[model samples]
Target: MTRPDRICVGAIAGSFGVQGEVRLKSFCADPEAIADYGPLWTEDGTRSFTVKLTRASVSGGVGARLSGVATKEQADALKGVQLFADRDRLPSLPDDEFYHADLIGLTAQDTGGVTLGTVRAVHNHGAGDMLEILGPGTKSALLVPFTLAVVPTVDLAARRIVVDMPEGLE
Candidate 1:
């Protein structure tokens, strides 16, 4: 379950060194800004941490120390822990851009106005964003490239998206 008040900003990639520093994989547009959104909370909201960035890690992530985590073992145990920040603390995006969270659960439709599916997830595997949609009567999910030509319309207020399905994809 996702909280509307919070947004996931980063994840712990395990201990960076023998010290208390942990390798952090930031999902922010400005990766270094992850530390600015301090007091990040765990998924279940049971735990929270103040981030202090130390340096950049070799794994393309930043090395950071979490509040109350003061040992190699302590940092190691927090591997894969996702960190979320209060939505209010984040900067607002321009009209053309959207947060991944906002895109999830939106209804997807074809250019002809036929119902396709609901967006189950938004993925970016180094290239660009893709929308994962699961429709009725289909056993598999549909992966649509989130480009302006493919997805011409996104009506967040209506909770729907207009997609121009590619010929080979259909």
Candidate 2:
């Protein structure tokens, strides 16, 4: 069963019409599938909403109506509010792929097996995924490219990652 500790899948982009519809931006692989994961929850899980897609959005998202939002004012209030779904509700990944949640918190080790740091977060800025490693006493986290050449192994069972640091990375 998917835990109630939801993983973010989408967000509200502001109201779409006078009839209480809002612009929804989905982060799912299939953008339209965002409505299938309902009822979506707030980050803290204190609130939830049933998402019903009405049509395509004009502002780069989809038009949708959220439960309890019956007026434009009501829908507009949800702008920027993120939507989350139970983790297990998400599709299973292939063996070579991984969810960002699964990669966080793993210990990072260098080629010589030296303990480097813990994985803090993963970021993707249109280029590729990058791992944020926070080593002890470091003022800033080390950003490592999550490439096959650099990250040769990710042992989820062992909660560790084997990294072959490129020159100047150390």
Report every candidate's CA lDDT. 0.92, 0.88
Q: What is the TM-score of each candidate against the true structure?
A: 0.96, 0.88
**How high a TM-score does candidate 2 get?**
0.88
How far residue 155's Cα lies from its native spot in candidate 2, in Å, is: 1.7
The most accurate candidate by lDDT is 1
Candidate 1 residue lDDT tens string, 68-119: 9999999999999999999999999988899888899999999899999999
Q: After superposition, how far is residue 83 of candidate 2 from its true place, in Å?
A: 1.5
RMSD of each: 1.1, 2.5
Question: Taking the tens digit of each residue's C-alpha lDDT, what string does model 2 give over 15-54?
Answer: 9879999899988877889999999988777888998899
Q: Which stretches of candidate 1 lie over 4 Å from their true place?
A: none
Badly placed stretches (over 4 Å) of model 2 are: 1-5
